[model samples]
Target: MKIVDKIGFDEILLQLAEEASELSQAALKLRRARMGINPTPITCEKANLHLLEEIADVTLCFGILNLSDTEFDYIEHTAKKKYRRWKKRLGIDKE
Candidate 1:
């Protein structure tokens, strides 16, 4: 039986969203740790580990969602566009 057959597609989508949110939160925590903003003292090493773990979870969700190479290419293209816009906003690039 296919993986999607065992687990409904809707569930996979939900899981992907949850994992992505978790990854975002992990990134925020890492930033907080680096800036020493949060009262809850956490080691930078632990924060980095947490972020890495969340990234792995999100990557696994992408696999379960059966992302294709074409989808990846589109994502890369969009990311490059966004990166260019970001650099321009920061005055790092003229274009």
Candidate 2:
């Protein structure tokens, strides 16, 4: 498929990226608020999660832009595997 054909998808990706960026900014603010003696680890963790989601969004955007179905399938599979691995490594389970 041509790049032009994917313009709508591109827009959606851009929107997702933008929202993620906003979320990261909010996370940063929350982090700064709980500095020094009373640090909120939970807030910091939420920030990290936001960052991870942003990274995933970027990865998905690139995959959508550049990969064929078979290639994208493999990429998505690998991403899911990696996400699961990272979640386990980080001890971040869904609530």
Off by over 4 Å in 1: none
30-92: candidate 1 lDDT, tens digit per residue: 898898866447888999999999999988887787878999999999999999999999999
Question: What does candidate 2's lDDT look like per residue over 1-95, in tens digits?
Answer: 65437577668667667866776776665666457355555666676776677677665657556658898789789999999988988889552
Model 2, CA-based lDDT: 0.68
Count of steric clashes across candidates, in order: 0, 0
Tell how far residue 8 is off in model 1, in angstroms. Answer: 2.0
Candidate that scores best on lDDT:
1
- Where does the lowest 10-residue lDDT sum fall in candidate 1? 35-44
**TM-score, one value per model:** 0.86, 0.38
